[model samples]
Target chain A: MKSKRILDALLAPMVAIIFSVVLASVILMLFGANPIETFSKMINYAATPRSISLILNSATTYYFSAVAVAIGFKMNLFNIGVNGQYRLATAVGALVAGALTFPGYISIPIVIFVSMLVGSLWAGIAAWLKVYRGVSEVISTIMLNFIAIGLIAYLLAPSMLGVQTAENVVGTPVIPESGRFPGFSIPGSQVPVYGMLFLAALLGFAYWFILNRTRFGFDLRSVGQSPSAAVASGVNVKRMTMYSMLLSGAVAGLVGLPLLLGAQYSFTVNFPGSYGFTGIAIALLGRNHPVGIAFGALLWAFLDVSSQILDLVGVPREIIVIMQGVIVLSVVIAYEITRRVKVRRQQDAVGKATAVAQ
Target chain B: MRRVIKIASVLFAGSLVLAACSSSDEAAVEENAAPVVKVGLAYDSGGRGDGTFNDAAAAGVDRAVAEFGVEVNEVEAADADGTPERAERLRLLASEGYNPVIAVGFAYSDALAEVAPEFPDTTFAIVDSVVDAPNVGSLIFAAEQGSFLVGTIAASASKSGKVGFIGGMEIDLIKAFQAGFEQGVKAVNPAATISVAYMGPAGDNSAWNAPDRAKTAVEGMIDKGVDIVYAAAGGSGLGMHQAIAAAGGSAKGYWGIGVDSDEYVLPARAEFKENIVTSMLKRVDTAVFDVIAGVVNGSPLTGIQNFDLSRGGVGYSSSNPVVSAFASVADGYAEKIKNGEITVSSTLTE
Candidate 1:
């Protein structure tokens, strides 16, 4: 039984990868580029030390984002608000870190914690709206993103942060030097800092523990599978739903820590990127499994890093975006196929057993 | 059992074939002739095709491709928060033989600092912010110099003694433009009152790109009896222009001043071209093209390249046919400003 389970686990990802490659090829051909060349360039570019570091850096944020989205997924809830939650958390954390001067060790943790709290709070607002007003999280979260932008903008302006120089640029004060993450050089290359990857791994393990080894996780999964069943089993479905979203937001908040506390140490207008949306792709790609998420994050990082190399090879960088969309679609289709196949086999086995018993 | 095993083996074999097929095709391409110069462009959040800043920078890249036949790769960082991702993207380009990577906007400054030294052989250029790296070239514009010229125009054209300055973000860079505009207005008409309102605060810079907020801010200024408004905001400037059009020939004839590359000529603002008193031309495209030109000619400029009004890098747009309507006033001030007769000071220290 154990061996069969292991085989199934390995086969799933392999199948997904194969499916993604085929889909990517069709996309490349549509764009009039050879699929083989594009995929090869992607792999070769990701093989380098610098490219590896870039991949790791990209993955750091994806881990948190994937886990956050996955939490909502487990509850059969779609938390499209990860983007807003993350933005709010990052803005608040950056403000807190930039405003107060603290020692490096203390400040970094405080900033990260504050970010998580702020993110949770932001998500909780939507959860509250959904629970009390019967408003859908999807709609509320989407609207909240615009509000988050406006609120953050107001706070970062001269009247609030007061960090602007004569240029009237809206950005927080630079975090004190002690508060910044130190970069460690790789043995032979000038590129430094691989610490964030370890941090991501640690977070991944934490996510796994919470999902599989804890009561809260069990309740979340039970509720996701069937709210009526969970209620009959004495689970507080509404509370669980709210908590799931809050927890998801908290996890998503961690996405900005590496960027904010790292070498830059300051929050700019473009600090959040599309990490919130990209996290959705990571969660979907990983099938909301923690281990799968880690791999998905790495794959995403690889694609992003490799796309730059594609530009060097005379290919448009936008092709990378097309490839990402293709990969996601292909993985989803492959998962559906696998699920159908498994169901059909199970039905066949059950019918044979019934005949033998009769 | 044998049937199941056979199916599994077939699936595995199919996967291997797929992977192999993709890898082999790439190998064939590399075996061919090497590509020429590889240039990577990292655009701002608005991305390329926004018909704005990113598009302007991409135009310079496209020009390089056409002129020198250099292989160009362009990526849109997509959002402000994606600087690290964008930086990582640039580093990837460097690793793959893209020698000179150009990151458009000051937002990439922090990322450039972390990534530039890692690839010392790879040269990086950042527009708007200065990075202190040997190989990194910081291309900055003297926006204040241009703002000063437009401020003069606004002061001269306004019937109301009250002028307004609408800024996108409250940054030191944009502040410089505001300060310069204020100074220029004061230089021409000492009694003119200049009210300054920024679209966003210090912590968030989206106000620079928010057209609605810009329009509201301009409308508010106009409501308070300010006739001529100078906009240092990017896309937000479009709002200011729109607000001017909306207030057409009202209590006080409203005039708008444009900024960043020449909004007076952009197709998006073509309708309001005549309403614009003048534009503070930042010339980012010209600077970008010049760098590409340098790279192709084997003499890529390094270190900081400052574009000031004195060098014609930053200044007011040429007397547009629309400006001809206000020609007498514009020509009068142009002569005075050019002949060392008027000094517009934007710096707080000055």
Candidate 2:
């Protein structure tokens, strides 16, 4: 029975993968490129050692974003403002880090903590709006993204960050070199130490533990599953909602640390990328499970990294976007199908047992 | 049912094998052809069809295809979310025989650094950022040089010596433009006050993409007794132009200066052709096309190429009717700057 359940658990993702490939192939056919060739090239490119490093690097941000989104999902909340949270956090982190003259050991952690605090504050505003003003978090967070962008731009502009020279255009003063995270080199390859991957994994495990083992986790989940029931059980639903959003923002803040401290070491206008929104897809694909999210992030990263070959094969890069959309759509459909199938099987067994008793 | 499943799995596996074999065969055919030059372009967050930077860069690719008759491929990143996606696209293009890939924004610097060394044979060109690699060409522009000219134009044309400069973001790059414009305005008309307001705060630089907000900001500037606003706000600058056009009062002759490509005659802003006082032309297309041409002609410059006013790579647009009216004044300033008579320093410290 356990083996069957394991098999069933695996089937949905497998079917989703198969359906995604088929859908991609159909689209490729319409574009007049041989789908087999294109897919093969993509697979081959993805399997390389350098590609593995790239995937790992990409997954770090993706995983964190997914965790942030998943935390909100657990509270029946949609944190659409992870993007805004990340932007605010990164700016705060970058500015604070840039201002400090501390050694690497003290500076990096302080920067990261400040970033998390700022990110939480930004997200907490949305939560406050949702709880007090009866505004939906989904709308509030989305609107906050625009406000964050505007504010950041205004602050970074010449009169504030002290535009030094032409060479440092579109960036804050470079974080002191001592404050940057050192890169670990992989032997026989140019890919640097993807230390952020391990950090993401640790955070994922922590998230999983907090969600499954702790009292706050239980309260949060209970509130999500049934707010009325949670209220009756003495859980503060509004407080839990606010806490979940704050936690979500904190997780999202970490998404920029790797880039700010490890690679770029300075804040650019669009430095964090779109990890916030992409994390939503990753969270859904993983079904809000930590381990599942890691796998989902890896798969998404692989597809993203591999699809670069589409251009070389005379296929429009937009097709990869279509494939991504199809994959997400198919996975959702497959998940629903498996769920319905399980419910139907249970009903059938119960009906048979009743008939026999009669 | 199990037998059917087995048969389907076998068919799928067969197709996979066939696909792999055919792709290899096609790759061999491509290899056998004339040294196929693969060029990869990592667009800005707006991606292609933005009718702005990405579109201008893609126009360079189109020119390469038409002029050199080389095989070309472009990757349009959906948004900033696709940084690694851009690098991956470069790697894929490299593996598939695309040489001399171009990443079109400063955003791709780190990604290029990570991906460039993996394929040493593949030459990379990144616009607006310096990546120190033997095979990489960093295309940077002296935006300040162009901004100086436009600032002079704005100052000379303004009736109210109080001109305005609305920027998309508050980065050093935009600051450089602002500084240069301020300097030029001071040089031409020292009494002219330049009120600067950026669209966003510190880090979130989405001001370049939001046209409505840009229009509002420009309108706000105009309301404060300022005319002839110079906008370096990317697509958002379009809003500034629109606002200027709407406030069609003769005494309040609000003019706008466009950035990057020449927007004075672009089809998108046909209505504001007359309202455009001047534009700071960064010439991204010229740089891109030149590099692609170099790749074709076997003379690609594999180091930093700084394009300034002297190179004709970055300058003010002389084609605009409004700008042409100030031909003698523009010429005088241009000659003075070129001949070391007027020095335009890029650093705030200077």
Candidate 3:
């Protein structure tokens, strides 16, 4: 029985991947390109040591973003505003860190702490609105995102928090080198692995441990499964909702730190966006499992990095986007089928045991 | 539930078997044919639709295709990962046997420097910045010289003593435009006041097409009694044209100076033609064409190819009849700039 459960868990994601590849082959053929040649070239190009580091760095950022979204998912809440939360937190934290000239140990933690605090506070507003004003979180969070963008735009002016550095670019003042996170060089590659990759690993472990081991985690799950049952069991549903949202936001805040401290050292106008939405997709694909999310993030990043080859082969790079969408859909369908099968098997086992007793 | 799972597993297995059983059909090779020279272009941020830089470069490629019958493949930078993606795109073009690869914009400076070394045989031409390499061509333009001519035109055309400059981003290249425009305005009318506003911060690609924000900026300038506005804001410049056209005071001599290509005759911008006095023609198309021509002729296309007033790389467009009246005067200044008798400041503070 134990081995069967493990087999089912492994089989579901595999089937989804196979289905996605077949669907993508059809798309490539439609575009008048050979799918076998394209996939072979992609695999060949992606296997390099340099490409591995690049993929790992991208995966590290995606992993954190996905974990943040998964926390909200566990409580049956959709936190779409991870985008705004992370950007605002990064901007504010980078601005503050730019003024300080402390050592790396002190300054890095301070930056991380401030980002988490700001992210939590921003998301706390949505939680408060939903709990007290009877507003749906989906609408409130989306509205808050636009408001945050406007506010950030206003603050980014030269007279405000922004400092113009080069022609066409205005951003927060530069953080001193002493306070920046130092990246480690990957063996046999020119690229360095992002220092915050360790932080992602730590956060992934914490996510799994908290959800499986803590009383608050149990309360959060109970509230998600059924609010009335949890109420009868004396769980504070409103409080659980607020806590889960805050936790989700705190994790989201760390999404940009890898780029900020390790790479850019300041929040430039070119700072990447849309990571929050990507996180939601990763969460759904992984079925909100911490270990599954790590693999999901890596796969997503791998496709993105490898798709540059298609551009050379006279094929548009958007084919990867189509394939990613198909994969997410197939995985969701496969998981549902697996769940139904498991339930039927458990019911049959119970009936057979009762017949033996009679 | 069990029945559904069984059906799903069967379907999944069936598809895999079908895919595996499919035989590979090899493409037939033809006899040796004439080897045609292929040119590759890697566009920055906004790519071809950007009415300013990239579009000008595309025009050059289009011209070459019409004239020389060469093949061209174009790639664009991915929005988020700028440097790595750019380098990869350049590398791919080189690997695919495209020679004399053209990378549009100064953003390709680092990418070209890295990738050009790896492909020592492929000729590379990068616009807006100089890269010191053996097989690389740096196509740069003297934007200030052209901008200075339009600045003079704007001052001459404005009824009010105030003119405005709306830039897409407050970067060095755009600042160079401001420097020349301000100097030209002040040179013609010493008492003229210039108001400058940028659309958004650096690194934000959306700023180039931010029409609504640009409209607000231009409207505010109009409210402040400015009768002339010069926009170097890419697609955002269209927003300024829309505002001026909708305001409809062109009969009172309220004018706009369009940047890059001639916006006066653009189909989408046809309604705003009357309001547009003259465009500061930054001939990126000419530069792009020149390099490809050099490659065909077996000439070394290396070092900085400067496009200034003398070489017709930059100038004032006389597409509108109303603006053509001052052409002789603009031409006189262009000759002086070409002769080194008049020098335009490339910096705002200068």
Better of 1 and 2 by DockQ: 2
**Best of the candidates, TM-score:** 2
Question: What does each candidate score in C-alpha RMSD?
Answer: 8.0, 7.9, 7.6
- Ordered list by DockQ, greatest first: 2, 1, 3
Instruction: Give the best candidate by lDDT.
Output: 3
Model 1 DockQ vs. reference: 0.20
Docking class of 3: incorrect
lDDT of 3 by residue, B46-135 (tens): 666566677788889888877777778877665556455577678778878988899987766656877898889889999887888899
* lDDT tens readout by residue for model 1, A229-301: 9999999998998899889889878877776676446666656645777777778778788888988998887
lDDT of each: 0.72, 0.75, 0.80
Q: What TM-scores do the predictions have?
A: 0.77, 0.79, 0.77
Task: Find the 10 residues in a row with the least total lDDT in model 2 chain A.
Answer: A162-171
